[model samples]
Target chain A: MKDFPYTESKDTRSGFGAGLHELGKTNPNVVALCADLIGSLKMDAFVKDFPERFFQVGIAEANMMGLAAGLTIGGKIPFTGTFANFSTGRVYDQIRQSIAYSGKNVKICASHAGLTLGEDGATHQILEDIGLMKMLPHMCVINPCDYNQTKAATLAIADYEGPVYLRFGRPVVPNFTPADQQFEIGKGVLLNEGADVSIFATGHLVWKAILAGKLLADKGINAEIINIHTIKPLDARMILESARKTRCVVTAEEHQMNGGLGDSIAQLLAREEPLPLEMVAVNDSFGESGTPDQLMEKYGLNETAIVAAVEKVMARKTK
Target chain B: MAQSTASETHAPEATKSVAELQQIATQVRRDIVRMVHAVNSGHPGGSLGCTELLVSLYFKVMQHTPEPFDMNGIGQDLFFLSNGHISPVFYSVLARSGYFPVSELATFRKLNSRLQGHPATHEHLPGIRIASGSLGQGLSVATGAAQAKKLNGDQSTVFVLMGDGELEEGQIWEAALYAPHHKVDNLMAFVDRNGQQIDGPTDKIGGLGDLRAKFEAFGWRVLETDGNQFETLLATIKEGQGLLGQGVPVMVLMDTQMGFGVDFMMGSHKWHGVAPNDEQLATALKQLEVEKASDY
Candidate 1:
């Protein structure tokens, strides 16, 4: 298998800031609103460059969500930036009524998603965002893998006409994806070609999945790795095709096992193409204060965890 | 652009005298009562309470287009119903002011009807720009619309109405704190100080003490008007509009009685969300009279 290599690591939130700053220069109608976490969200560049279009909504995420919805009424595309917890649960009703249910063009760009948020504890680390956002009918939920992919997803969603939940993380992980890649929503990225198992991963877990692929390769077990970015309109065709080829599946994401990438894939596979499956996700639980690495390892979200899940599913695969 | 929409149909009419506006308000009150009573569901108390404000805004104050309704509302005025439980009044005013067919008022809360129990834009309703059954979100939406208008160099004002009780929601204060800081002068927010909510009197349940002082302290140019009357309230709204584009938002505290027109429903929070029955509907309808326009 050809190794996916990266020389540098970067935070996905910076990618969001970079994309937003570029959008500020390109699309005049693109407006940014932050609920008082400009530095954490890495939105200072956009704020400094496009002060006129930036809205500092203080510590009120609900108002920010509602404001973003209202901004769409006058042909303005509003991008609201906040922590994943604040972005999803705190302001869910605002998002539901104004943005999602109203079909407003608002991009809810959430940073510090999942356990990778690091040290801020369970109160800040939101493990249930994917489920809450994906449940909304008109809302598109996306969780890009790395810095380049995050930036590309940010840029692509600007042209999309509806509410979108673009999830990213605070940790500086491997920036492995192409810098100039065209991000397509609901389309999975194939990182490897193998026959033994299909490794479906998303968000920060994608890099871990790639590492797991390398490990399984050394063990003479061919593994296929696919990056699922959009969790709402899932890439069913790609997932099922990969599953059919591999016969067994392993789904991974830095989210809860209850309502996440794994849950979605499990349902999809059970319905269209039933296969032996194992998931690398946090079983219904809350996160606590720890370094990103510690959290991932403790929560069984690292490469080793994926390998373990693969091994478990391999044993269940039918000959 | 607001002045040029087809005035005779599906658009707000040209400026009318105080008497003529009162007549339209009467017809609107009739529409509000009948629409709610038809479904045996919906809020008529607050709807009837704010009839004068809704009628006055559509007929006299706002420069808006009802025909070929644009969600963007660029270069034209926009109105957001923040107190959306009072949708009875909002829907009545929207239909009578030409946003939709007045006859469609019959489908107020019916399935497959644009006139949802709460104001919703997803129904493809002509005038509604956002969904707002949930309280305390309307002001934020209006503030954003006002800011959008400013960015587009469109001087048209954005109006939003909230019940006084809705102020209890923290989101309202958040928008309250943000608007004046951002210099959102193009927005005009009103509180239907009908002094009642679902449970009881607003002050008794959750005291909204000193609203004029509260808004003034928040850096808004505050105006208190009698919302039950056409002449003075319309004049107060006109004066509020003049304060726009001047670097600060405006807030108006409008005083009106809950279930204002119908005597039996008036002065009680019990009618806050309850619709009138057959006998009550006939009694309520008899209380509202207008010489100019008939009921749909």
Candidate 2:
């Protein structure tokens, strides 16, 4: 198994702020809008550096979505900042008609995603954003794993046209990905080359999958681990090729099993290759107030859960 | 037939007489009734109600281009249909003013046509800047476009037309607070105070009491216009345009009957989205005939 080390831990929202600040310096057409959550979203660097290009839209997510759509009309690439719940569900119609249907170039950068947005309860933590954004016709859904990857994805999406949903979390997780990695949308990164089972993970669960790979290696099971950052235009070729080698697959995410990374991978596998697959994700349940680590353990989204899922799927594989 | 040159780009010509605008509005009303009757599915009541306002803006007021339709619309005045159910009027004025072929009005709401049930930019429709069928979103969009104009140092205006019942949406109130606070003075917004919606009278559905006072409370420069009268509306728009660049956005409370042109369909909620049959179409056409202007 390939060892991935982290220097320190940092929130992915800070990565977005750093990337936005970089874009503010490089791209003149890049403008930022926030719905009264600059501090929480860690957008202070962009706001302070490019005060003229930033807009404080004040507590109206629907209006922010609309304004973002309209800004595209004048050839301005707008990045809207807010929480995951307010970004997707609170203004779905605004996004549907104004941004998605119109095919505007707006980056909906959502922070505090999934159960890791601890202690704020179910109202603030959003797990269904990936499903909601991916369902839109012209939307590109991306959930980067670590701080370095999130910053790289943020910079990469500025050059990409059309609507994008960049989802990141609030908690300070392991910053394991390379600092200068070229974040490619819809391209999966191979972390380990193994043949026993394939482990597909995204967002915060990616680091856990890396840890799970080591655990499986000790048990004489060589696990193939892949990080799927972009969810919508999934790296299907990479996933299928890995699945063909391993023959059994385990998908992990910090979201519901109903409409998340697991569901998307399962559909791809069912259509292309019939393989035994197990998902390590939160079952049909809402998240409540808890620490990020406690929530990951209780909801079965940690490395142990992924190891268990791999074992369960490997047992069901055809001999 | 002198072959109407009215559709040609009139480089900021704000001098067109009210009679000329009224003549175009009558022809536009005829197009609205005919287009809706052809589809048998559209909102004709609000379309007919807003006909004069659209005609005044397109033919007499807005400084825009029709030959080469630019999506950016940087140095040109832009318009957005907030309450996009009134697409019949929007489509009629756009086609009649030569954004596309005038004959394309026949393809309204048809399959594989650019004219969807709502105004959408996805089809690359010439005049539409953004898609709007869902209400309470246009004002915010227009405000953003206005901000873009300011960023580019382009001294052009952004206009948006909305329905009275659309105000019941919470986003409208959010935008109501946004424009004034942001000093989005280059945007001119109009509310079609037509007193009726699809469910019934707006008073019975959800009363929007005292719009002038409501807009004033939101720190906007409010003006009222008789939307059915071309002369009064042109004057009101001229006055409203004067209030631009004064650190406050402008709002026009346009008083209009639900079905303004056709006597039978007038002043009621029943015709809000209902199309006219053959006999009703003939009645509406007879009332909205223009001697000089030709129908598409």
Among all candidates shown, the one with the greatest DockQ? 1
For candidate 2, the docking band is medium
What is the C-alpha local distance difference test score of each model?
0.90, 0.91
lDDT of 2 at A259: 80
lDDT string, candidate 2, A1-319, tens digits: 9988888999999999999999999999999999999998889999998998999999999999998898887889999999999999999999999999999999999999999999999999888889899999979999999999999999999999999999998999889889989999999999999999999999999999998998999999999999999998989999999999999999999888888998999999999998999999889889999999999999999999999999999999988
Q: Given the true complex, what DockQ would model 1 score?
A: 0.83
TM-score of chain A of each: 0.99, 0.99
lDDT of 1 by residue, A1-319 (tens): 7678898999999999999999999999999999889999899999999999999988999999989998888899999999999999999999999999899999999999999888989999999999999989978999998999999999999999999999998999889899988999889999999999999999999999989988998999999999999997999999999999999999999999988999999999999999999999999899999999999999999999999999999999998
> How accurately is candidate 2 docked according to DockQ?
0.77
Evaluated against the true structure, the overall lDDT of model 1 is 0.90
Per-model i-RMS: 0.6, 0.7
lDDT of 2 by residue, B45-127 (tens): 99989988998888877888877998888888889999999999999899888899989888899999999999998889899
Runs of candidate 1 exceeding 4 Å displacement: B1-12
